[model samples]
Target chain A: MNSFTPDRTSFEARLHKIGDERYHDKHPFHHLLHSGGCTPDQVRAWVINRYYYQSRIPMKDAAFLSRVTDPALRRSWRRRIEDHDGTEDGTGGIHRWLRLAEGVGLDPDYVSSARGVLPATRFAVDAYVRFVRDEPMLPAVASSLTELFAPKIHKDRIAGLLEHYEFANSDTISYFQHRLSEAPKDVAFGLEWVLDHAVTKADQDAAANALIFKTEVLWAQLDALYSAYVSPARIPPGAWQPGEGLLQ
Target chain B: MNSFTPDRTSFEARLHKIGDERYHDKHPFHHLLHSGGCTPDQVRAWVINRYYYQSRIPMKDAAFLSRVTDPALRRSWRRRIEDHDGTEDGTGGIHRWLRLAEGVGLDPDYVSSARGVLPATRFAVDAYVRFVRDEPMLPAVASSLTELFAPKIHKDRIAGLLEHYEFANSDTISYFQHRLSEAPKDVAFGLEWVLDHAVTKADQDAAANALIFKTEVLWAQLDALYSAYVSPARIPPGAWQPGEGLLQ
Candidate 1:
């Protein structure tokens, strides 16, 4: 009996539904952000902590590639690494991240080292990597399907950061600029990979689970940040002190 | 004795020498950049490809932590991660990175995924990670000693990009604005680490080598961008398409 079936919707719709439900819009931080309820210290803390996960996605993709057994899948998936780490000579997403690090008043070297990242952010991003690593290959690839709905979030995020945050700037966020094009391509590839491989009811269930897991991965990071930076005490260790038109 | 030993200049001077002889300043693109010789396409490629590397630095740092066994060292080193990641979750350095992406008029997700980033960029960044992981721990820390010299280069790069690259706005590059303060703190910490840890002649030599290695890692990425995007080709296979007024 096929207990769990792939509810065939436009891949976009399914992914969008995930965002609609779990994308942090309902979180207090979003409310505070859009409503301008956050403190400047909160904003600075937000900027400093998120950089860890920002820096990890590409390398984690590379680690994921190392675990995959299929050559065709490997060939296709390895590009994520190149997208982040760059080629034989350098010049890629990591470098762009350094520029972002600088924008938030971080030293690129310190930022890049991930030495001081929030425990929760590290755990969430680590969970993302571990999810991709431990899951079925189909689901592993499926996890990245988040990109299917990314352009919309990307748009909202850019406008929200620029309009609401004081320390924020569009140029400092250039890492996202290129993602508009890259996400479509990556989603298309990931979608096709999942569709081709996830033919069983079980696979479909796993695929949905992968998406949920990824959502949690992102959600948890945000939750940690909100707890640490957004509210009552701002007690997270190593948080950035705000001043001079910072994230307020 | 292996004779790549550097002379006894002030630590700052030694660091500056690394920048002078091996920094991207010597790269052809910088010359073309400062001389007003690059086409719009060349500038666009530079912006887009570099975005990949800019986004990934902190990940390498995290991975470095994953490998190291010391708790106190990790505790101290962890501060770097917080500086870059910030406390607001994605609103931190990663979010700021997204802003930079938006400034370039690229999609944040696409940029974050680094799908269209250049191959050369990947190579250089990987080299940094590899250098950290492959070398002795002190040199690995020393490799990051490059931060000491960054304030000057960052200032120069900002001035040059603003002056020579018409596509950029000061706001677009706000990531650097924050770095002016952050880099010095980090450099002080790193320099202190190296001076204290480089307890032997070989250790000092490795520190020097680390600085050289870091400088080359950055310079090579620029070189690759120059060759692929500037003048002759306009756009290379999988390189970014040049757009007007999108200087990064």
Candidate 2:
């Protein structure tokens, strides 16, 4: 190991520190969403954009898996795709997310079609898939360490939604409910994989930077959402307009 | 040709119509920018983020070039890389953009480093590169059709900057000055290439969508800028903050 390399515990702490400081949970959009301060349109917009992220998660994992030479790593990563895409359609995290969309009064088909996703949201999410597709595996795996922060958000989302919104029933929020279990199991493996592989100081920094990039990916989506739907709402052309894509 | 294929004149009009409606020139951000209504900080933010797009132009061209199987096409495309990167340092469109950054009081080195660009800016710009790298050559070439709209925006920008901002000058605004000529030259070739090749209705649709996608790429950068620096400005966590990267 290099002289600059942090001890494993310290490195792990550094990774968690990135999450504490930079994760989307800290974004105001989430604050609004969780506190019942969001209008129904705000919630619907979240559903539409967040669905874009959730939809891309499996593709990113698959991209990561495609580059993995080791059978063990590939096998481990395959579960992530399965988690989001499910064994069949109408299941998995994505379908459950559509359930949430339906609960929020959006047309599930419209959300699924992704016709209304903001340009920024698409760019941010697509960048994640490209990052995994092209980066060296170390940073790529480290990117998933944002999963390190996901469980708490999932828990908070579940509780917050149930308490605040009429749309927050078990069926509606099942995506978060499932993620509450799914993310922890996934993050344990990812965190261990990153900590074990990030032995050099350079490697550690790349890992941390990748995680930071992931946080930005999450954070930028909310920024787009907030700017487009929340305050001084200047919806970009061709993005979801209020009153479009509703379940009739 | 297919039954739905429009005559060449009509097809060309369709492409121009896309620009008429969907081009970044129509974005309010450009309206504010061209009118010189932006605060210095807003101008600086524009410099930082717009630099990311300008910086990537050669790479996107190179990515496009790499996939071109024809020698004639490759030779024609080579000029784009030269236009941005120049034959030597301290030359080319990018360096001229840096001059504008310097004129606006930002450190040239800081703008070049791209450390503080918004995540959305990076994503949108990188998406353009990836689109060129991965898409079929027809849509890939078609994506460059937004240059059709560029000459006018460049003309407006030159006039607007000169009229409204102290930073505007021959040296500082040389990028747009050059583009006023360069864009017409480039877009003439790109528009012809797309029009000649998009013979079928589906091909025309793909080409049109590609152009639309390119417009979004351009517009999203402004949307990000507007969100980050304009009304209800909520800068994302890692983007360029107003006071960072200023020249002494």
Name the candidate that leads on lDDT. 2
Stretches of candidate 2 exceeding 4 Å from the true structure: B1-248
What is the per-residue lDDT of model 1 for residues A1-248, given as tens digits with 9 covering 90 to 100?
Answer: 24465454644466567767876556677667655567655655565666676666764665565444333454455456556655433356666766665676666666556665678888888788777656667778878877876787667666777787665676676777777777898889888777776666777778877888887887787788787666555656664444422322
Candidate 2 at residue B18, lDDT? 94
- Score candidate 1 by DockQ: 0.02
Q: Is the docking of candidate 2 incorrect, acceptable, medium or high quality?
A: incorrect
User: Lowest-scoring 10 consecutive residues by lDDT in candidate 2 chain A?
Assistant: A66-75
For residues B62-108, what per-residue lDDT tens digits would candidate 1 score against the true structure?
Answer: 55554444333544554455455554444345556556667656666
Clashing pairs in 2: none
Instruction: State the interface C-alpha RMSD of candidate 2.
Output: 18.0
Question: Which parts of model 1 are misplaced by more than 4 Å?
Answer: A1-248, B1-16, B34-39, B70-72, B164-167, B243-248
The per-model DockQ list reads 0.02, 0.01
Alpha-carbon deviation at B150 in model 1, angstroms: 1.4
